[model samples]
Target: MAAKTDRSDININRSMPPGKIIPELVYDDLDQAVVWLCQAFGFKERLHFRNHRCQLVLGEASFIAKANPTLTESSNNNRLQPQPNQMDHSVLVRIEDVDQHFEQAVKSGASVISPPKDYPYGERQYSVEDIGGHIWTFSQSIADVDLSEWSGVLSDNPEDAF
Candidate 1:
């Protein structure tokens, strides 16, 4: 089809949240989730909807923490639920220092899945499970490694790679 046009010049509604893609994580306890995420993950609370949802931000990134819907409150098609014991997905965040972030998360009682380790892809990263059982990965780029060096395939469209 056709290439997408840039929309940066267009004015966005002020009521809408920022970020091209914002993830909404469901939690059983909205208040506790907000507090734990702030303390452990260093996310600052941006906006809170009483007892329902809250927007969070770290640097220029943003996401939302929403309350899990009760069975009676939602239909199966639209119901939201907290993370189950088995992880189906994880959120990855780029930070300035992976080591420092891991330490702070550990100190704040995050359950460590993997400690910080450097990868051939030129990043230092770690994984942890939050209070709501959601997995989060924090990473820091340590070098600008060539994709070929790590056996990574480059996209034909260079703009799609980033």
Candidate 2:
């Protein structure tokens, strides 16, 4: 078998392009969803769209919410309708301060879930359930720790054990 040869002079892509990551959450009402999203996650509305079908929708952070069920269904594959005892999904949004964001959401009519708490992953995060049953978790980076410390308590094994 021949070993693969590198074509370094060909200008091949050595570094990956930045990824565009934006998750869209669908709701039964676009207007209400927009309000809740802005309040819960602090997403800024960017644009809106409408057609002859009367589907009023708005876009924020690459996410679009529809005012009607038909449009919501078409926008997001993980469309939701609150069940009796089960949850369909949740959205985790990165923020500067989860405690402050949680308080803001509470003031904006969001139902509190777990209060902002520190996690092993260096995040102080909290949860809120919107009126439409969408779960939004706001998280903030807390501290930088070694992976071992992050996993739990630091190991006491001798450094020479390796």
Candidate 3:
């Protein structure tokens, strides 16, 4: 006879919400990265795991962080992510006030990539890099300007080509 296993302690309702995308990031020092993210960008720690991985939440947006994987490990594809401060991609977030957020980030010692500026498409935006060298773009909508007026694009009719 097969032995019966107890299965009373399980929670199936705990999982990420539907239609939510969570981006994963790698850091050299996850502790400092978490602290910097909270201080500079206002993300609260949602969960911490094994001293190497953590989850950060800001409103409905969230991202998971893990220590950078070793390059010598033998795994499928045998590849590793680019070192911190070397990646070219950036994370963009929408906020209420671009200028105030920019000031706070600057005060928290984040490296400024671009100062706040208004764009024709109705966005006041700025860019910065955190201590782990992750580029972040914070933007706020300032207007509802028509796209056609700025770039002469997005025609109303299909025959308006060229």
Candidate 4:
């Protein structure tokens, strides 16, 4: 679930909505990644189906997770087909408990790139990688620092002394 939500006027029905992310990953074994994500990161399974070619699918989308292949602009295969992207960008997920979540992911075989750290923007977050090599950065807002008091923020007061 999204913790620090930006001010919004749109009325949403559900507690959460599907995340919008597009990433390409290389995986000969897709099923393994799906199962591990559900168990490790709490992403629920949404739907499973077959494409036009009748290939079995494991598309699971929820408020937290969306599993699908990312389309690439180029392909080197002799068949001249567009292949799913193997190298991709990291997806950052903001959560409530950075320490607990990071521990759980580590227990579930995720390699940690960095531990939780407090950022100036008021968040304590950590990062991990799934088996398929996709980086998932889970973050949480821990400190609510007043940027107005900082030396460089845009505000009437340039420093706390004011």
Task: Give the winner by TM-score.
Answer: 1
Question: Residue 152 deviation, candidate 3, in Å?
Answer: 7.9
lDDT, candidate 4, 127-146, per-residue tens: 77777667778888877778
Residue 63 of model 3, lDDT score? 83
Could you tell me the lDDT of residue 29 within candidate 4?
46
Model 2 per-residue lDDT tens digits across residues 50-126: 52011212232244444545554354445446642356777776777677777778888888878889988788988
What candidate 4 gets wrong by more than 4 Å, as runs, is: 1-26, 51-88, 148-162
Per-residue lDDT of candidate 1, residues 1-162 (tens digit): 333336653446544456778898888888999999999999999999767789999997889998876622542446556454678788999999898899999999999999999999999999999998899999999999999999999778989644
Q: In model 1, which residue pairs have backbone atoms overlapping below 3 Å?
A: none
Q: How badly does each model clash, as a count of residue pairs?
A: 0, 1, 0, 1
lDDT against the true structure, per candidate, is 0.85, 0.60, 0.76, 0.57
Which has the better TM-score: candidate 1, or candidate 4?
1
TM-score of structure candidate 2: 0.64
TM-score of each: 0.86, 0.64, 0.74, 0.57
Better of 2 and 4 by TM-score: 2
Clash pairs of candidate 3? Answer: none
Q: Over 4 Å off in model 1, which ranges?
A: 1-11, 71-85, 160-162
